[model samples]
Target chain A: MVTSRDIAQRAGVSQATVSRVLQGNSRVAPDTRERVLAAMRATDYRPHAAARAMKTRRSQTIGVVIADITNPFYPELLEAVSHALDQSGQRMILWNSAGPGEYSALQAIREGSVDGLLFTTVTEGAAPLTEALVHEEPVVLLHRGLEEAQCDQVVSDNVAGGSIVADYLVRAGHEHIGYLQGPELPSTAVHRERGFRRRLHQLGMDLRPELVGRAGFQHDTARTLIRSMLHEPVPPTAVFCANDLAAFGAIDGARSLGVHVPEDLWVVGYDDIAMAAWDSFNLTSVRQPIADLAHTAVQLLLERITDPDLPVRHELFTNSLTVRGSTAHTPLDPPAEQRDSHADD
Target chain B: MVTSRDIAQRAGVSQATVSRVLQGNSRVAPDTRERVLAAMRATDYRPHAAARAMKTRRSQTIGVVIADITNPFYPELLEAVSHALDQSGQRMILWNSAGPGEYSALQAIREGSVDGLLFTTVTEGAAPLTEALVHEEPVVLLHRGLEEAQCDQVVSDNVAGGSIVADYLVRAGHEHIGYLQGPELPSTAVHRERGFRRRLHQLGMDLRPELVGRAGFQHDTARTLIRSMLHEPVPPTAVFCANDLAAFGAIDGARSLGVHVPEDLWVVGYDDIAMAAWDSFNLTSVRQPIADLAHTAVQLLLERITDPDLPVRHELFTNSLTVRGSTAHTPLDPPAEQRDSHADD
Candidate 1:
């Protein structure tokens, strides 16, 4: 058990200074704080957070609310958030919001079990977010943001990502394109669709109302949705899915109908997860710096926790296109000859 | 806003009885406790865990330590544990051990931040486990177990699972087989290998030393390991990987060298993760009842925390095989004719 006195000695500082650092006091010099943190790391110091909580009235824990854990994207985001929180010397309490109605994080924060809350997934106008803000709790939103919330948020430029996919497909002469729309409540899905639709209109390739299909997080749901959309009279030559999982489902659904990817159709996904690079999927996707987003969210939340007076901040990261085998080739012209083969469907 | 009085009125019990239930008092009658709990759930009661901690010296929180979150298996396990804890009216603090040297959970438990610790992954003779036991902190091991620990453990029978795989391969007329071994520390890996080797010896088809290769959780690591093993003059016709991820890697590695799965080579994995059922992989794997294992582990830990005098227990689950497309067919004889093309390696 390393003590504050030992940390002070190692960093050439007084025990009082070490205590101040632990309290997240801004009065401490930056260099001195860094040295103290380094010493603590080197000594494997384990601060008694419970004792400190009693004195500071802060639990030194942050509650992270995730809607789903089985989704590969959430796990990746959680890893990043966990590392970031670990660096801030704060513990993370994971709350799975089993449904949109779950408000476990808000209750946990109100009870002082956690000092702040980080919502990686939340719907627009969520009751818990409104209640948390009314109570003046430290809150930060990541991955998803609300349209009319006065809160700190760290997210990617989802609209621009969707627009990029639209432009890529249109430039490849894909006039008949389809979109997979996710649940309507989340700002991420809404903004993404907004951008995609607006861009396709600008490109003189307005998306057909019948081509837009609804999809959930489940692969089977996406498969059924896409299969029904493709069974229409004039099917899409390319499909832009809301996320990587949706894209995988779309590709498999098309293949089940004997449509060859990149030859008969092209598929694009969002959120370039690790599976996107697997030879099995080889999916083209929009890459958001999830780690950077998570780290920034943690930083903003900690700052708000340390000083409640700080103005709300919205940090947006840029998204880029990651091309892969899914959309490796964009034919110059509509293959009338290829279309003849699937005319029956 | 829901209080003990409201709960008492709803359950038709005295407020004192409701308080006893909130305090986890063992003297409360089982029927009374169930009714009080039902009323609490109906009212969406949020107990002040921090305040309760001050009065009862119990945080109503459990610290769960997972070595890696990116592994799909952990997320599934975590979902089950979270549901179980929610039912027990407890919160969960997740600690990503990040590496073997991490001991954050032990420190958190010692400081009364969490009532007990649940280790989903831990090495044999880990220092933190030993110290936690020495300090008498309630602990339970899940997914992985220590050889010489006096702690409650809930795990699937990996030994039997390994033997089943061995028996399957040998019965399929595979004399030359390879094994992809995971990290040497965890009992899940050690015991799995023990059962596999012993069963192979019993069947008179011992695993060759050259065919056994070391791999890690990373897909690329497993790919490189299996590729090198298959590059030998007398490569194996069947390979059993440590986990599903490794099996995917092995299949891809063999395919990269012009060998076909279930034709010239067969691959098997453990854990039977959801990905195993994906069309791209469709891998055969040993299925462990992960949800049951997680729920049982939580129940055991809560019992131990409520009554520290409870004797330690080990709960072992049975494993079954999930046959998929990866092993759809087995030739009547050795695949010598199919192996001729790859013999130059």
Candidate 2:
């Protein structure tokens, strides 16, 4: 283990000069920087991370708290974030919050292990943890938003996404459509519900309470809920799912019941995950600008990490509707129209 | 900040006793342990992670190096590993190895910030950084096996899985079959190829060079390669993919070319990922005992962490075939007979 002193001695420079060159300080001459780097390579000098952290008071690390990586959507977002962070030579320490509670998340926040935090909580109310993180370091919320907390957030326009689905459904001549909502507390779920309901009212269509199903953002729960929805005295002709996972469940449920998608019923999902494009699902979904959201969140967090006094920023990217085979048929189609007209409101 | 001294004073115990109780040494009396815990809670005393590391010579943290989380297989493995590590009161520090080179991963290992390393490398070659980890700390290789390195490894039997698929294909009376292979260098890929070839030879069949397509472990690349295979002068009646993602690409490729799955051609994939059961793919794949692999890796790593003198271990788990609609056809079908007659070796 060669030290800075050893490198300095070998390069015929002072230890301070070696440190400056290693840190890429502007004060160091280009020739000196090259010499120091060459000496470091030759000697295999590895800086002690703990010592560096003590000296600079910076770990050059950020914490990413994701609810679940099993969900394809979060991984895509993580990939983008990791790529952006790597560019700045900053490392991301990932923590999975998929367990029973937020205890681990809070533990990570209070330890002062990271310079900043990027949290994607499963629920909308994480005020205590949010406050704790804010007190210790700059916090940026991604995907899941907290309504009561005033924090920097980067999320897709879920409300507009829901409304866009409604618009597409209505244009396809579906008047009585059901909504499969995610967990009640997640802000994205609530906003999407609001948008769906508002658009339904605007279209002069009544939303039937029986037509709605709420799942805790899980595939099995969504499947059970959707299965029951189909068995109702009169099922809605089209169903709008809260997320891609739930949408997949609904599709599976329909298949189990021998219901032909887009023929007997139309299914639409949000968050056009990579699987949505597979030949199996071909799911019609609202594509969240995930890459844009990742870029915005990273940029915002970087700004805050550099200068914590920067005003809190909220970036809401627009969503787009990707039409696929699942929602291909219009309600005007004879059999589908008949099913739509006889549907209970 | 309240320290152990405060807790000792409040609990009427010595500082050593308080430290012992906090460390869960199990030698302390229950009453004294409870008193110390209550006093510490009352005083809001939180242990400093850095100080603890200095005393214990352990960070109580493990580094997990994953190539990509967006890949479904990696997340499943990560979740299991995280859960197992959490039960032992250890934290996992994630390092994404999706960068250009192994520099970042090597930096993490050389720094000694973590107690051990769990790596999931994409490339088959033994990286210099991996060798360094083996020499420096307790290293566990997950999924991807290294041929050169002698270290603890936990992997599903890819060779057995490949053989299972070959057996199924032969049982179904498919004489002409295509094999979609991943990159050549990876151990898993090599093992799968060996198993598939051996099983085919045992069944009195020889692998046709033209029927084998090579693609990196990526869906898009597999899609292109599989498309070309489907357009061959005389396409095989059944195709065995390297993994679920590639199987999905093959399914999509077949659909794009108006080839009906299980009707015109059969498709079987390895690694029965979550998406395999989705309404779209419904792919017949070999189920990798993920939870077992995860638990085994964690247990092996912990043993090494506890005592570095432990010998390196390699655990192999058996894989089961999951039959799905993708390859539901039987040999008695007329299409199978036609395919057998058209086979050109």
Candidate 3:
């Protein structure tokens, strides 16, 4: 039941100034805007988003298109995005793409449905969808980016993450290594593959074409692929999976083949999901700034919403290596370091 | 560009009938409504929710407030809810409560935001939230229900789920058992604990005070609590964790104390999250019909939204035991049988 006048009184600002801030006017001073935001937070004043949207022609809702909600990675990303959006008085309308073909993103982003769009599922062939989406609303690419789209983008440094894994695995003395990847469509997978190969090439090594397999972003598919690869006479002594889920599958496939992780075979994964540190998997993986990536995406989207004339911006977040039992020579990741990387961690 | 006319033609109905169905008018016949829904899905007809809300004062956006989206259980629940809502031509605005005290649900449910709410994180003593939410909106409790709130609710049979675990462990011949529970606020914990203790009493056994611990629904907290329990002079031969994350923690705690899962100590968890079937954890868990629960909750909410005068209803879904490697005797779960439990599983 709190009102803007009450917040204005508490923040020592005029009611008109508070209204201006609520409307996302660019003329307000930074300090004044900060005070108004602080007062709103202190008083728990929700400014009737739908009412405001009706008046301003903005819905105060962000359309979030996720490839799969059940994937642990997307959930983690969403947790951060939700927290950030809540602070700014924006609501998130979530759309799970279900699978590649199960959803129509173009139809979903109809006019006035949301203030903007944050997409986490921009795979390779998604250019047409993004192309159509850009003409309709302000769109921000999150986690996944499209080369063909000229929109604001925030993503993890997949290439660097891949390189970190390659560096760690090579340092651990693994020569015969394999690379397991997700679908070729996802830029995340492509960039990760690029980084891993780029680093291996720098280290005077290469993953032969026959040693790479694609799992189509499925855990079971990854397991089947790894099982076949491990059954060969000249199998890989180490493997680097595009993501942690694939890495878990590789471990299971290795176990079924009577090979122990970090002993007879070493495995590395990307995206370092929460399960990586569990006593069960103890997967060695690359840690992306999930919270930062989400926060930056939301922040950039808001800026674009506030000022449509702003030039398109792309932000890339760095990633670090989290070493665990999955690798032969990597030490166990301590809890304190993980906590230090992200505030939400 | 799929339109009401397209859906109407596909359903063999007039455009007026399709419009009536989209508006959620109670005059539409059930079979006609179903046909309209099917046609809409087939043709990928996505109604502009905001534009519709402006015209009809009924937003097709359901506000979903969850406790912690990072928890695999919640993400799984959200996946089901999103899928069901999509089929019904509605959108989901996700609000991750983050944790206790970080959000106020009643405040978040402003009048103009969403037509209904689907709450997945209702703990005991949340009377104030539901009390305010019910008067302002058509709210349906999903996964968690409040005893004090007169709202439509769909939840798992936690009492029966707890009883199933007791029955299975007793049949497996484990006498010394411990129970690891989530926070006291959640009704699920209370109901689960009640059923577990009741079954133990029926078997002429009881859990001592020292054998019970609360994890506050956190993985690390569970690990610490289980570690202390395991270090006792005489530890339990089996432990029943309220959820899979806690069960994973129990396994880790036991391993730290030189005890092995399914050999020296047995662990059973609830919710049967996707991780339970992984080659790593393979936790034996009670599987709730998550998809059915979500679908039913949305259907109930829609019914209530169409006719707010209807009597409030409650649905309790039965959960089945999914046997996997975490137990001492149960074999690994096969994927085909995994889908046989639920119709849409």
Candidate 4:
């Protein structure tokens, strides 16, 4: 069993340099890398990382459970996590929990194939996650979270974000603002909704129950529901979506009904994803520190792995509002019109 | 061990029905599910899936090697592959081979952690992949290709897609059309370049040396390079990007220089990702049958897993050009102007 120290001693290089060479980090000088390789060959020493796994049950792999891989946000998050894991010489296995493969997903953990699990999505009352808690799984929640779970969590301030949007819409003179709520199971939705409602109350206004819709977190669903909701006699003058995808849906839905965004109905979303900056959507959104959140989650996961009995930790990343064309109150645009269902996309 | 046959017999259902029930496929009736579980408990039969895996040395997991996971196209392809794998009861481990992490990525198979590997990006001179081939790794290529490789491959007709773009641009009366190619290592870039040039040659016009650039396949890179290219004495009237992301870059680049798309410079791209349809880009692109390609790749990998000695296979999927505002040739637009780099995003 050759170790980093043995390789370093044989090559006359530092242990960190030898480890970097093993991980294929490109910072090592070419000549130094050759020396390390020559030493490894001369010593007839195989790294045999798998052998250590047999003794310690560390697979050097982590399983990530994402809610929806199709969403651009999850892929971006996965990319960041993958790069971080690669830096630490670890592999990633993705499990799409949106599918009907929950049994096999849990089995992967129970079989000890992965060292730990990084959950990107865990909603409130996630009964399936109880199995992970029962066995005291090495799990860390990412951006999405579970309020009651006894696990390390790293999340952005959704309440503050929602409040910011609420204040922005009210200041823009939107009295009948609607809310496109994410599914209530996730803490993001619950907290954001609370913040929005609390801000409205502070402004001496109340969010009408009929103006809110707690539907699944999806684009097409949000589009369809928003279109139908807009058909009502007194539609909302503004809409606040819990996430960027929903905001896109709301804008598209409003367009389908011949309603102008910002001019007729203001639209805002949280999580200023890259698409928000595009000239088309130009959605005013709350930007979460995705990179910081992901990096912190990785650090927390590694800490818990080093000490199993470590107390749980909760981290909250701050958020900022990105003002764009979506929420701009322009008076030059025409007034809102009734539904134009015959228009083609 | 509880086999599907025994479960079927005890539950008074077909073997396929019992298997479907175990897979949690919703097609099974409630009564049938109840009967199967009741029978399993009465017979004290447990599905020893892990025991079977131990005997067969099968981890029931496959590795997918992708060039860039952050790219939107890769995630959609991954989602389709995951669903396909789930239908066949296989798991996917992703390998982002974009950076210097190629060594450990291939080692996963060298040590037999995964049953097989599905490569989504294997360039012409990929030395690391040859090592996997030396060990007779069960590998299948998907979407992207290698000019010469001894593995099952699934690729779209990129050459034809390029030819279509060329003919469309030529028919639209554009002679000085530039080509925004991907990195030359992958066969996709090679074949697409060939197809585009061949079509141009058929029209008695070849791609000028000065009109072609092999810049890296990325949005920001394409934008910067295209911006610099547009400043030449005779800028191209149209451009064909290797991928949609590059087309977006071209559009944003052109916009940055106050050049209008379709009116000033027609732009077409490959891989009609969902973003192409957004009102911001409205890009015309070649739509690859990603679902079919992914399904075929999974099938090929599974077949290879069952019989590693099977003869090498190559598959090509047909693609169609999706025309949108980007290629509509709307002349009622402003002409190109000098760039204002100082303008903020």
Q: For all candidates, state DockQ relative to the true structure.
A: 0.59, 0.51, 0.52, 0.33
lDDT per residue, candidate 3, A1-345, as tens digits? 898779889989998788768855556788999999989888888777656656677766677888787778888888888877866667677777734322443444555656777888877666545565556457788998876677888988898888887776665555667889878788899999999999999998888776789975567777888888877777787899998888888887886677888767778888888878877678889898988998888888877877788988988889998878876454333244332332221
Off by over 4 Å in 2: A1-48, A98-102, A133-136, A329-345, B1-46, B98-102, B329-345
**lDDT of the candidates, in the order given:** 0.82, 0.76, 0.77, 0.77
The digit string of per-residue lDDT tens for model 2 on A1-345 reads 788889999999999787655433344677887888889889888777768767655566777888878978778888888887765556777788643324555565456457677777646455545555557467788887766666688988888888887777876667567888888778888988889889878988768998888975677777788888888888767899999898888888888788888777788988898888876678989888887787778767766765677776787788888888888643233355543554423
DockQ of 1: 0.59
Highest-scoring model, DockQ? 1
Reference-based lDDT, residue A315, model 1: 91
By lDDT, the better pick of 2 and 4 is 4
TM-score of chain A of each: 0.89, 0.80, 0.85, 0.82
**Candidate with the greatest TM-score versus the true structure:** 1
RMSD of 4: 8.3
Task: Write one digit per residue (lDDT tens) for candidate 4, span B1-345.
Answer: 666678789899897676555544444678888898788788887666566456556677888888787678898899889988876667888887743444566777666568788888877767766877887888888988875788889999999988988777766667677888898778888888889989899998788777777655788778877787788787888889998888888887887788988778778888998878765577989999999999888888877876688899999999998888887643223222211111110
Q: Cα lDDT for residue B25, model 4?
A: 40
Q: What is the TM-score of chain B alone in each candidate?
A: 0.88, 0.82, 0.84, 0.83
Give a tens-digit lDDT track for model 1, residues A1-345: 788889999999998788777865556789999999999999998676766677677877888989888888999999999888876667788887634324767777777778888988888767788888998989999999986789999999999998988888876667678888877878788888888989988988888988888876556677787788788888888899988888888877886677878677788989999988876677889898999999999888988888899888999999998888888543344345444543433
- Residue-level lDDT for A135 in candidate 4: 80
